[model samples]
Target: MLKFPNNFLWGAAASAPQTEGHSLLNGKSATIWDKWFEMNPEKFNNNQGPSDTSNTYEMYHEDVLDMKKIGMNSYRTSISWARLLPDGKTLNSEAIKFYRSYFQDMLDNDIKPIINLFHFDMPWWLMEKGGWENRESVDDFAFYAKTAFEQFGDLVHDWTTFNEPMVHVECGYLYGFHYPAIVDMKKAVQVGYHTLMAHVMATKAFRDSKVKGKIGIILNVLPAYSRSESSEDLKAKAASDLLNTRSFLDPAVLGKIPEELVDLLSENELLPEVEPSDQQNIKENTVDFIGINYYQPRRVQAPTNPKVPAKMPEDLYEPYDWPDKKINPYRGWEIYPKALYDISIMMRDDYKNIPWYVSENGMGVADEERFMNDDGMINDQYRIDFIKEHLEQLHKGIEAGSNCFGYHMWTFNDCWSWLNGYRNRYGFYRVDLNNHFKRTVKKSGLWFRELVENNGF
Candidate 1:
């Protein structure tokens, strides 16, 4: 058994867009997600949209009881900007009251509340205005962040300015994974820069506020692996690292952009429109901590076409091939536990001594309820072992002097995933979405209860 510090946080994580289902609240304007689902329902897996989610907006008190039952000492959730400010200008009173009461419930229940201002749910009005690509949307994000800090800062102690900014840039702009999907790399660069600026602004705002808490950003980081010792493969792996992780990480924690990225962007004429003041803000307003979400390791080989493209530097990495690999028996994600340790070591040594938490990590299994036995319980021993194996690597990272603060799984209860919808379950408690979404504790939930109480497996 590995020992953690006494004050270590043990909980689960969920995003507003994924968990909270009150999309059409009082005077609440639609987010990009709402608009996207409304426009194209076929984009998501199984054509399941984001209209009626887990309904956490209404059942949060019940959910908190579920958290308490599972022995969670901390809870991580995000605030939907559109929920608070429908028009991007006028604040919604009912929305504010709901979240205020939500935070107060967690604090009153002895659960430390971790709040994220933005979690990929960009307001539709802002998206129509070019989202993060336009400089004005940057100002709108700052307004949302400031508003959240001022209103919820009283009860929410830990603040995450943005959730996975790199993902937002890559998915929303570059790779077109999320709403208003665009493939232009220039827009991607601009959006990335604006997201960082928003984080910097939000961090400063939170610090200056009356709320007493820590401000950080959550990044989904995958350890990069080279296929071989060839210089091309190694360089390709480095390129993948620069684009995927270091782009936002360099500026947020180290307070500067990576030279490799800068050179690439400059050559392509896709450099972000950054003001001199933005640089100063990033340098001056570094985060107190960072939240890392790891699912798998990235394996890369040399690009077949070594020549750089006319516009964008061919970040050509040999494509990933996951054939006959070690698989998590009960889930869809490939098992690569070493990536967790490698990522933590990289953060502890390469970057500044920034404390980190496992903001989100869990295997998503199909038919979670099928594992439930006749004893009126779920016997998910595989899921239990999955969590234990990851925690072992996390424990090794901590023992090696990594400044890791906590570990939170992907979620407390089965909730809606973005593209995967409700097909996959990544929770200790399974929610029967078809039958009024009744929450049921799995064997993993009971195991996690003891794990939290013992602070180790």
Candidate 2:
């Protein structure tokens, strides 16, 4: 049996727009998701949009009860910018009341609430003004972050400045998978730089407020592995890692941009305009902890020809397929449990073993209902096995002196994904979208309850 530390926090995470159903209600304004759905409804699976999700806005009290029933000691969720500051400046009283009640309900149940200031849901008004590409967005986001701290800091202690900053930069600016999709390399680098600047400014605001808590940023850290021992393959892997991982990791933790990445961007004329004072703020207000959202490892190989300055980072390196790699058949993602251990050791050795946690880790299946057994229960043994293997690897890392203190799964209930909508389910509790959003705990949910109760498997 593997046991975790006594204070190990076991829980699940979800975002505001993903879970909350009342998207436009209670004085809330439309976010990018709402506008995107309006312009392109066909982009979402089954034509399901963000207007109605799991109805968390109305049923949060019951949801908190469900969390307690699952034996979760902590819960991580984000506050919607569109909900609180509908126009990005004015405060919505209803939104404030709702969040206070929602957070209080969690604390009342003895569950620590870990709040993230920003998820992917940006206000429509802000996106119209060039989003993060505009330098003024840094101050706008800083104001929002300061307001959130002033209002809710007394109720919560653990705060994340941004959830997966790299994801927004890649998907929105470079990959064209999210809202205001623009395939521009220069804009991607600019948005990423400004997002990092916003994080630094928010950290400074938190410090100035004297709020008694830890503030960090969540990064989706996927380690890149070379296809072979050849120098070219190793170089490809390093480039992939620098773009996907270190772009946000180095600035958030080390408080400085990696010189190699800066040189590459500068050579290509894609380096963002950085103010002199911005570096000082970042260097002085580095995060107290780091959040790692590891799902899979990236397998890469050297480009076949002389590299042209590509518009997308992935275009610079070639993706490699391992012959005998384990696969998540439904999701089409490689299932390498050992990657978690490798990442933990990399952090311990290279990142100075700063405190961190597995903020979001889980599998998403296309049709989870097919796994349901008799008694109307979804016997999701696959999810249980997935968690078991990953946790075992995490326990190994902890035993080796890694400073990982918690593990929060991807989500608590099935909710609206950005483009996939309800196609993939990554929740402990199965949400019946057809039946008033009724939630049923899957077999894996019970398994997780036992895991938390025992603090191990």
Candidate 3:
């Protein structure tokens, strides 16, 4: 039998834009997601938009009750910038009221709340003024973060400054998968820099405000592995890791970016100009903890045709799939439970093992009704196996002296994804969209209840 720590945080994670359905209610202005859906509905799977999500905004009381029912001691959710400050300058009283009630309800149910300030839902007004690419947006985000701390600092104790900031930079700026899609390497670099600066400013604000909680940032760390033992392949893996993982991890955790990456960016003239004060602020205000969101490992190989002064990820190394590796047929992500353990050990040995947790780790499946049993409950044994395998590896890491504190699943309920929308469901509760977003606990949900109740498998 595997065991977890006594104070383990058993919970599931959710974000505002993905779970909350009241996108336009009560002075809530448009987020980049809303505007993106309107501009190009075809980009989303099945034309599903944010307006008709799981309706968590209106049904949060019931949702919190469900969380309690599932034996969750903690719940991670985000406050919408667009909802809290609709015009980017004025605070929305209705949003304030809703969030306070939401947090209070979670607390009332004995569930600790972990609130994230930004989760890829930038307000449209901010995006209009160059979003994170503009240095001014850093100050704006700091103001927003301070406002959130002032309003809910007492109710929530665990605050995350940003959730997966790299996704916003890579997807929105370099890959064109998210809102304000632009495939410019310089813009992506700038956006990434400003995001780090914003996090620093927010951390300073949280520290100065004397908030009663810890503040950190959630990073999706995809460990890069070489396809072969060749030095070229190894170099390729290092470069990929520097670009995808260390680009955010080093600065957020160590208060400085990797010198190799900095030199590469400088050589290419893609480095964002860093102000002296920004450097001082970032160096002084590091996070209290780190949130590691591990999904899968990136398999890279020496590029067949590498470019000089590569501008983007694709230009530097070639991505390859390891032979005979298991894959998630539903979402096309590789299943490598060992990657979690590998990351834990890496952090322990190289990164000083700063206190951290598995912030977002789960499987997303499409057309999950096929997994439903005759009793009308989803027999999502696949999800159970996914969780169990990952947990086993996590337990091994813990026993090996990794400073992992908790594990929060990717989501609490079936919610909207950016491009996939509801096509991929990563929720313990099956949501019936046609039936007013009615939720039913799946078999894995029950299994998780037992795991949490017992503190392990």
Worst 10 residues of 1 by lDDT: 306-315
Which residue pairs show backbone clashes in model 1? none
TM agreement with the true structure for every prediction: 0.95, 0.98, 0.98
Model 2 clash pairs? none
- Compared with the true structure, model 3 gives a TM-score of 0.98
Q: Per-residue alpha-carbon lDDT of model 1 for 1-457, expressed as tens digits? A: 7878779999999988888786876667898878888888888878777777888888999999889999999989998888899989898999888899898988888999999888889888887888888888767877888898788777877889888888888777766688777887777778888887877877777767757878889998877888788898888888788878898788778988789988866765677787878878878888888999887777778877654542333555765655645775544457888788888799889887688888988888888667779976878898788788888898898888888999999889888877778888888888887678788899999999999999997
Compute the lDDT of residue 410 as modeled in candidate 3.
Answer: 81
RMSD of each: 1.9, 1.1, 1.0
Q: For residues 1-457, write the lDDT of model 3, one tens digit per residue.
A: 7989989999999899899888988789999988988898888889998897899988899999999888999998899999998887898999989999999999999999999999999999998998988899999999999999999998998999999999999899988888788988888999999999999999999999997989888999868888898999888888888878888788778887899998878877788878978767877898878888987888999998876777677667788878978999888889999999998898888778889999999999999999888988999898999999999999999999999999999878988988888898999999999998899999888999999989998
Score each candidate by Cα lDDT. 0.82, 0.90, 0.89
- Model 2: how far residue 128 lies from native, Å: 1.1
Of candidate 3, the 10-residue stretch with the lowest lDDT total is: 306-315
Error of 1 at 321 (Å): 3.0
